[model samples]
Target: MNLHPRIAADTLPVCITPDAHVRLMNDNRWPWLLLIPLQEHIEELHDLTHEQRDRFMADVNQVSRVLQRFTQCKSVNVAMLGNVVSQLHCHVVARDDNDPNWPGTVWGFGTAVPYEPGQADELLATVRKSFK
Candidate 1:
């Protein structure tokens, strides 16, 4: 399935799982990942079939663990809000008190800081390796 334009614009492809397309948000302020389900026209979690939902949850759990392990952050935030982008996607964000947003949510907090050259590449490589 094709990704929503907004998601495609804001994220870089990381890896493809059986049920979702994993992408890394471009912002370097935090370690964020997006898991977009491959099912067409799915706007919410309830829209997924039981099997699909199970697979999607597996993807979320795996990605969340990978993000936590890679960043060793204070916490991992997982959310599925479709207010701006209606696509069925999950956000796995690594949060630490030292991060810019800190105690606040990353949404609409500030402009994203793009990853420097090779920075995103290194992260993508690390995350991909963990999935193996």
Candidate 2:
């Protein structure tokens, strides 16, 4: 069986759930978080067992709460569309009306501004601390 590249690369930050991880997009303009369910064959929500599905939702809620508290975003946009990656993943983006893509979608607008080294460390620390 083929492995998800994400799992192999160990690129994203893992949460308490064994089957979930967080990927911080290197975007300074927006606080974007990717929640990936670590099941190997899950292409959709129904692909998960009922219990697994419930657990996924719990993870999503917890992440959303943390993002709201830390980012103080005007709105939190959670999406599960798999048009590009074709993986069962969720995007929890913190948005504001004043943002560049404000009142519009954040996808395909422009290149992502990679997070600065110091800021990346800080953001990672904030998320890690929140989970404790």
Candidate 3:
């Protein structure tokens, strides 16, 4: 299945699991990742079959653990809001009390801060290694 254009534009490829395509959000303010299921035309979680859902959840859990360990943040937030992009995807974000959007959601909280040259590459390498 092809990724939604918006997601493809905003994220960098990370790695793929059995059920989903993992990608890192371009923003550097938070350690955020997206898990997009590999099924076609799936706009909601309920659209996935039982086995697919299970696999997707496993992918989410794995990504969350990786983010938690890598960031050591105060908390990790996960959500699947398809309001803007109708494609089904899960967001796993690492949050800290000192973050700019502390005590609130990251959605539209502020403009994204782009990573410096090679910054995203370094992070992607570290995260990819952790998955192994």
Candidate 4:
């Protein structure tokens, strides 16, 4: 299935995996990445073949490594909840106790602060470099 245009390469601030479709978090302060499986009718992990599932898990790990290196986060939270979009996407969130939304869940806390142009560029570069 086609992904949201906003999640596409050109629109995303970072391009970690050249061929793999990746989306950088719009929340500037939080080091986050969203990985959407490039498959149609995939509402859950079970929807994917065994091989595809393995690849997806590996991709998640790769993204975690990137977040760990760049953000130096105190902890990493990975979740896949299809309640909202139902598109079978995974979220890799880098969290720290010092973060504004930290010590609490990132969801439903408050509005996300969009990244500044320069900050976004730097983060984009860092994430892209992490993949290499």
Candidate 5:
């Protein structure tokens, strides 16, 4: 599937495969990923075929486990809110009480803080290694 222009514009490419596009959110406040299935015209989960659904869950689990392992987050939040971007995407966010939006939604709470040089390098490297 062709990635939505808005998604390509918003995130930095991390790792991608035939079935999924993995990207790191520009905001570094909390470790996050936007996972999009590479299936044509799949605007929602129900739109996917049974095989696609199975593969999609595997992809989600991949990202979720990686985030939990590296971040050691108190909890990991997985959400698929397609309100603004009609494209079906899952947000795998690592969170702790220390995060800015603790006990609340991370959206609209504050401006996103971009990742620093070293932090970005380390994160991308670790994630890439895990996927390999």
Candidate 6:
């Protein structure tokens, strides 16, 4: 329950486990996934304890693998930028060279193209299925 203020507004909920909250980036242009650890008052990865860090990384890997498998993305990008949200979270982006922001960063590149209702639901379902 230690989510940051901006996450709810900027992202759509996908699922919540003991260690992290999995969310869709709300951008359909790219398959951007987020893993926000449920640890309270943490703004950086280093703030996590050793065990917590391990579990967090595991969650990140799980999401990254599923993203690659499902999206057939050329490359997967992972990052944790706290400047805006200030929460301890990881972004797992599925990128292709042809993308508008190709060979560069996805942040602040342009306005987000959100997922259609069915697309979003299907994506969420795929991710949840992968976990099981």
Order of the predicted models by TM-score, top scorer first: 1, 6, 3, 5, 2, 4
Q: Which candidate do you rate higher for TM-score, 1 or 3?
A: 1
Better of 2 and 5 by lDDT: 5
TM-score: the better of candidates 2 and 3: 3
lDDT of 6 at 1: 76
- Residue-wise C-alpha lDDT for candidate 2, range 1-132, written one tens digit per residue: 333575334234534455476777656778777777777767787888998888888878877888888878899999988776666878788888888889788888887676655776766677667667
How well is each residue in 1-132 modelled by candidate 4, as lDDT tens digits?
Answer: 487554443235455353345677777667778888877768798988998888888888888887887778999999988776767878888999999887887776777677667776766676676677
Off by over 4 Å in 4: 4-13, 16-19
Runs in model 1 with CA error above 4 Å? none
lDDT, candidate 6, residue 73?
85
Task: Encode model 6's per-residue lDDT on 90-111: one tens digit a residue.
Answer: 9999999988889899999899
C-alpha lDDT (0 to 100) for residue 66 of candidate 3:
78
Candidate with the greatest TM-score versus the true structure: 1
Among all windows of ten consecutive residues in candidate 1, which has the lowest summed lDDT?
Answer: 122-131
TM-score of the candidate numbered 4? 0.84
Per-candidate TM-score against the hidden true structure = 0.96, 0.85, 0.94, 0.84, 0.93, 0.94
lDDT of each: 0.92, 0.73, 0.90, 0.74, 0.85, 0.87
Decoy 5 TM-score against native? 0.93
Q: What is the lDDT of residue 98 in candidate 4?
A: 94
**Top candidate, metric lDDT:** 1
Candidate 6, overall lDDT? Answer: 0.87
TM-score of 6: 0.94
Q: Compared with the true structure, what per-residue lDDT tens digits does model 1 show for residues 1-132?
A: 899999999999999878899999999999999999999999999999999999999989988898888888999999999999999999999999999989899999889998888887877997788667
RMSD of each: 0.9, 2.8, 1.2, 2.8, 1.3, 1.1
User: lDDT, candidate 2, residue 56?
Assistant: 85
Q: At residue 69, give the lDDT of candidate 1.
A: 83
